[model samples]
Target: MSSASSSSVSAAAPASDWSAARIAEAAAEIVAGEQLPAIVQAGHPVLRTRAVAFDGQLDAELLDALLTIMRRTMHEAPGVGLAAPQIGLPLRLAVLEDTWAADEEIAHTRSREPLPFVAMVNPAYIPVGDGRAEFFEGCLSVRGYTAVVRRPDRVEARWSAPDGAARAAEFRGWQARIVQHETDHLGGTLYLDKAEARSLCANEEYSARWAQSTPEHAARALGF
Candidate 1:
């Protein structure tokens, strides 16, 4: 979600109701019902609400399992990141990994690179420079749509790991976008709210027309 907030945003009790053991129970129910845990889609109450801060709400066992499941879910979705709210747990937790690069040229153009899996809790970020960049982005929650969203080109990010270890790192380019996208979920923000409306398109159209190393051409054509 974007930093732009509206009156529709709500708080805990709704999405944050699941955490610790509650999350496990929810997943178990999904499995028991012969369904895999699903991504909470747009318009759901869970996606419209802010995630709760992670402050010892889960025991070590629950935390580990939750992180594992989240990572697996993200990988299975084959997405670079997955936030807690996307999976019905509105806690400040998310997993991220991006190992794909079509080729060296695209990688360098977007500053894209392989990022190992990491589970961030209560994550936050601040722009590292005045630099900004724009590119098409898609969300697992939003499903088959993509849009151009401008974001800080670099950032100083801080979050606690699943192991309770604190981390502060500098991220730039595509990785910075990934961090911001996931962190926005904790605040009940979606990239849609911040995206250039004119650039919105179905995933198919995105691939059929605007799939490029950068968004400059699309931005010009879409009048965004």
Candidate 2:
């Protein structure tokens, strides 16, 4: 598989230069309504740093405020999911929502459905089987591109709700994809790490060239 070229943002700075202060500044811009926080690019130190567990540190007021910000940020970025590290917060937290239901073709291809807004803390997932599904993926943190990533088709996740209640459920298809992707962020992992490098491309190029392709087609055409 050929490795995809890095986006300008991901290559703009060395990994070491992305300090917490920089992340804080970026985050403050969003919280203060100055501007939406720039999504931390893939090579930024924050994206690669392992996130800390929220545990019991977050009180009701803090958690509520954080959730509001995160949901707004996710919607502003127009992404289905957002993790804490993506906005410079190294906490095991993520928000996701997919208001639109998949069309018949897409539903048949990936079994995706609309998802309500969700906030998860300290989320972890386990693969259900050897079954795997591959699809094009993009990230707010990575920016400007997408790549084919093969992931477990189903997963059982354990997480905490805002009220400190334990939650566990099995997710399949695109739902599983969203959970796995967000949880990976907490562990300092990115889909690029597991992507078919040759299949990566700029968003425009992907839409023009491979948007209609399926996992089997991608494997045949891109050698993933």
Candidate 3:
């Protein structure tokens, strides 16, 4: 089968309350068939441009469609999070998977663990606690490169949920980093902007060093 057909089949097969027919219809409207999104490459103007604020109500069909697209795109690309702009949609919204859970088998194996899906709309973050951690970062838009970026080990974020409920929540460790990274994308800032000079690396180099560095040391090395 063609890659596009294969992707369509995969996306269609996810078992969720979200209807397959609805997903297929919405996907057709927002995405171009099964083609991979034209991820805004590093130098693209849109990648650097701050997205316009989303002024409409959150519970609309469009928001639902966007959420689906974000989920599918992130899943297809295997990233922990994605911002609307990365897929050429200009909206102040992003999605992040809780990476901490993904990294630890004990966490993932727990029955009550929250699903990895999270969506933030018009979100803002406040760093909580003075501790910081550094971790290797990669972007779907800037495929094949990785960087070390430092971020607060925890943060307090406020945003409206997809259902229009206001939320204030604390996130720590890798979850904190993922939220901050995806939030920056909504604001049109790539990790490269916040990345420390020495921490930047091609994928292979990053893989080599990521295993050796302490979290704190990695954060500092990445200029976080």
Candidate 4:
């Protein structure tokens, strides 16, 4: 699949250094702002660069503030998840939560489930069992379109929690998909890298023709 190589949005990034005090100061500036920080979009260098793994870059109090804003930004974006690079911070931090309407049929077909908010640092995942689920996915960075991406249906997710404690758990269904997408950000990967080019469609087209819970119809028509 050919990846789009264009961008129409950008952000003014804070300085990138390995200093804890500098990171804390920049993060504090963000927390102090009234407006939501700009979400860096496609073609931004930070989004394509590997993120620095969290390693006590910020003290506990500032770390909490950073996580809080990340969480709030995700909710405000009305997206299920967001990554640090998407906000112009090249740190291996991400926030994820899944919420949806109570449509029984859609919920069952999409394997949709609600997930509580999580802040993961230096996260990674491995497939639990091999089987694939293909669905239309989109990203805030790659705004205005979505494509069919096949992903593992289950995974063993692991990461460090805000309290600097190690955490691991099994996730399946849509929750697993969320984990894969967010974790990919840490490695400088986007869903489009794994998407079927034939299934790429603008958001309007998706609403008009391919909004099904499953991408079976899209896959067949697109011949992926």
Pick the lDDT winner. 4
Collision pairs in model 2: 2-198
Please identify model 2 stretches exceeding 4 Å from their true place: 1-34
In model 4, pairs of residues that clash are none
lDDT tens per residue, model 3, 1-224 = 00000000112122223233443443355654456675677777656665555566333776876688777777777766778768666566788764332334423322113336778877878788798765566788887887667778778888878877888888776667776777777665777776776766677765565544343555556555
Regions of candidate 1 where Cα sits further than 4 Å from its true position: 1-35
For every candidate in turn, the CA RMSD to the true structure comes to: 4.5, 6.1, 10.6, 5.8
User: CA lDDT of each candidate?
Assistant: 0.77, 0.73, 0.62, 0.78
lDDT of 1 by residue, 64-122 (tens): 77777777777777788888888887778888888754567667887887777888988
Better candidate number, 1 or 2, judged by lDDT: 1
The lDDT ranking, best first, is: 4, 1, 2, 3
lDDT of 2 at 109: 81
Candidate 4 lDDT, tens digit per residue, 1-224? 01110011113333344456655666788888998888888898777766777888788888898888988888777788888878878778889887646467767976888888889988888887787888888888888899988888888888999898999999898888888888887667788888899999998888888877678887888787
Q: How would the candidate models be sorted by TM-score, starting from the highest?
A: 4, 1, 2, 3
Clashing pairs in 1: 1-189, 1-190, 1-191, 2-190
Better candidate number, 1 or 4, judged by lDDT: 4
Q: Is candidate 2 or candidate 3 better by TM-score?
A: 2
Q: What is the lDDT of residue 64 in candidate 1?
A: 78
lDDT of 2 by residue, 85-114 (tens): 888777678887876545578677876877
The best candidate by TM-score is 4
